[model samples]
Target: MAVIPVAIAGAPYEVRIEAGLLARAGEHCRPFLRKNRVAIVTDENVAAEWQAPVTASFDAVGIASDWLILPPGESTKGWEQLARVVDWLLALEVERKDNIVALGGGVIGDLTGFAASMVKRGCGFIQIPTTLLAQVDSSVGGKTAINTPAGKNLVGAFHQPSLVLADPLALDTLPLRDTRAGYAEVVKYGLIDDAPFFEWCEANGAKLLAGDSAARETAIAKSVAAKARIVAADEKETAGIRALLNLGHTFGHALEAETGFSDRLLHGEGVALGMVLAARFSARQGLMSGQDAGRIVAHMEAVGLPSSLKALGLDCSGRRLSDHMLHDKKMDAGTLPFLLLRGIGETFLAKDVDLNEVAAFLDEELRG
Candidate 1:
C-alpha cells in the first residue's frame, strides 16, 4: 500500500492506494465513523459489481451500509441528483462529524462530496473511487461539483474527503476504453511538469493498461503525489499553480459540451484529444515545435485515444464548439486562460488567448 498526503490547509488528508483496498474498506473507514451505520452513495453500474463485497466488509465489523444507488452517467451529476443525495443524507441523520462513503466513479464522488459539503452546512465523506479517472484525478482533490445547463462543474464547491481508498483492482472491472480514457489524466501529470515521467509513460503506459499491477501502482502514486503538491500550494486556485492541472481541460470541456456530455465522448477521451489539440495549437502559435506536437499525437494514437478533430465527426462549426467555451469557469475579463505547451512537459497558462483565434485554429483542424 502507498499513501499520499494532500496537505490542504486545515483539511489535511491521505490517499491510500493498493490493489485490494476495496475489500478491506471497513477496516480503514472504521476510525472515521461515529456510528455503526454509514451511508454509501454509488451508481447502478458500480453497485451491481461491488455492493456485495463492500457491504460484506462493513458487515464484518458490525457496521451497516445503507446505499443510495443512482443511475450512472455524466447526467447524474446535476441539480436533480444533487438534491436527491442531500435529502438521502439528511434522512440518514448524518451529522457534520459523521463520514459518508462515496463508492463509485467520479459521478458518485462528486455528487456525494457536494452533498456532504452542504449537509448541515458540512459533513465528512470517504472516497472509494471505482474508476481509473476518479482514482487518479477526481477523488483526491477537494473540488466537487455538478454540471449545470451553462457548463460542467459550474455549480460546485471545494469539499475535501476525509480519506481516499483507490484500489487499482477496481479498474479490473472497468472497460478497456474507460481505462484508457482515465490514463489520459495520468499522462497529464507528466505533460504538465515531469519530463522524466512523460518519458516513463511513453515506455510503460501500454504495460499499465495491459494490467501490470506494479505499473498501475507506480502511475497512480506518482500522479497523486503530483496533484497533492499542487493542491497544497494552491487549494483554491487563487494562485496560478493549480491552474496548470487544467492542462487539457478547457478544450476537453468544450468538446464534452459539444458531444452533450454523453458516452459519445468520455471525459478522459475528450482530455486526450484536448491535449493533442493543445499541443498542435501551441505549435501553430509558434510556442512549441511541430516535432514535439507530433510526439504527443503519436503517443495518444498509440494508446488508442482520439488525437484528431476531424475524426470526432462533429457536424458543428469550430465557432459552434468555441462558443461552448464561453461559459467556462476559467474565463476572466472576456478571455479564457489556455494551457499551452512550449514543448513536451513544458506547459504554461496563456492568459491572453483569443477565442476567435482558437475558433480559426479549430476550423483549420476541422477542415483537415
Candidate 2:
C-alpha cells in the first residue's frame, strides 16, 4: 500500500492506495471507529459489487453497519438526495462522533460528506473511493459538494475526511470507458507542473489502462502526491497556487453544464477537452507555442479521451459554450479568471481576461 499525506488547514489526513484495500478498511480506520454504529453511503451499483466485502470487514471489527444507497448519476447530487441521506443518518441515530463511511465514487463521497457536514452541526466521515476519478482527485481534498440546478457543486462544504481508503481493486469492476475518462485527471497533474510526468504518461498510461498493476500503482501514487503537495500549500484555494489545480475545470464545467451534466460528457471527458482548449487559447494569445497546443491535443487523443468540442458531437459553437461559462462559479464581480498555459508543465491564471474576447476565440474555433 502507498500512503499519501494530505495536509489541510485544520485537519490533515492520509490517503491509502492499494489493490484489495477495502477488505482492510476497518483496520485502516480503527482509530476513527469509536462508536459501534456506522452509516455507509453508496450508490446501488457500488453496493451490489462492494457491500459484502465492506460489511464483512466491519463485522470483523465488531461494528454494526447501516447503508443508504442512492441511484448512480450526476442527477442524484441534489437537495432531494441530500435530504434523504440526512434523514437516513438521523434514523440511524448517528452521533457527532460516529463516523459516516462514503463507500462509492465521487458522487457518493460528495453527497455523504456534505450531509455529515450539515446534520447536527457536523460529524466524522471516511472516504472509500471506488472510481479512479474519485481516488486521484475528489476523495483526498476536503471539497465535498452536491450539484444544484443552477450549476455544478453550488452547494457544499470543506468537510475533510478523517481517513481516505482507496482500493484500486474496486476499479476492476468499472467500465473501460469510465476508467479512461478518469485518466484525464491523472494526466492533468502532469500538465499543471510536471513535464517529465507528462512524458511518462504519454508512454505508460496505455499500459496502466491495460491493467498493468505496476503502472496503475505508479500513476495513482504520483497523482496523489502531486495533489497532496498542492493541498498542503493552499488548503482553502485562497492562494493562486491552488487554483492551478483548476487547470481544466473552468472550461470543463461549462461543457458539463451545456450537456446537462449527463453521461454524454463525463467530467473527465470535459476536463480532457478543456485542457486542450486551454492550451489552444493560450497559444492564440501568444502566451504559448502552437506546438505545445498540438502536443496537448495529441496526448488526449492517444488516451481515447476527447480533445475538442466537435469530437464530442456537440454542434454548439464556441459562443454557445461561452454562454454556458457565464454561470460558472469562478466568475467574480463579472470577471472570470482563466488558467492558461505558457508551455507544457507551466500554467498561470489570467485574471484580467475579457470574457468577450474568450467568446470571440471560441467563435473562431467553432467556425474553423
Winner by lDDT:
1
Q: Give the worst 10-residue stretch by lDDT in candidate 1.
A: 328-337
**Candidate 2 at 183: error in angstroms?**
0.5
In candidate 2, what are the lDDT values of residues 1-368, reduced to their tens digit? 89888878678888989898998877777779877768899999999998899888888888878888889988888999999999999888888888899998889989999999988899989999999899888887788898887889887888889999988888889998888888998999989999999999999989988888888888889998999999889877878788898888888998898899999999888898889889998999999999989988998888799886665666787777887877777777887889999899998889988777888887776665
Q: How many residue pairs clash per model?
A: 0, 0
Per-residue lDDT tens digits for candidate 1, residues 174-235, read: 99999999999999999999989999999999999999999999999999999999999999
Error of 1 at 82 (Å): 0.8
Q: How far does residue 235 in candidate 1 sit from its true spot (Å)?
A: 0.2
Each model's lDDT comes to 0.94, 0.87
Steric clash pairs (candidate 2): none
Cα error of candidate 2 at position 157, Å: 1.0
lDDT over C-alpha atoms for residue 131 of model 2 = 90
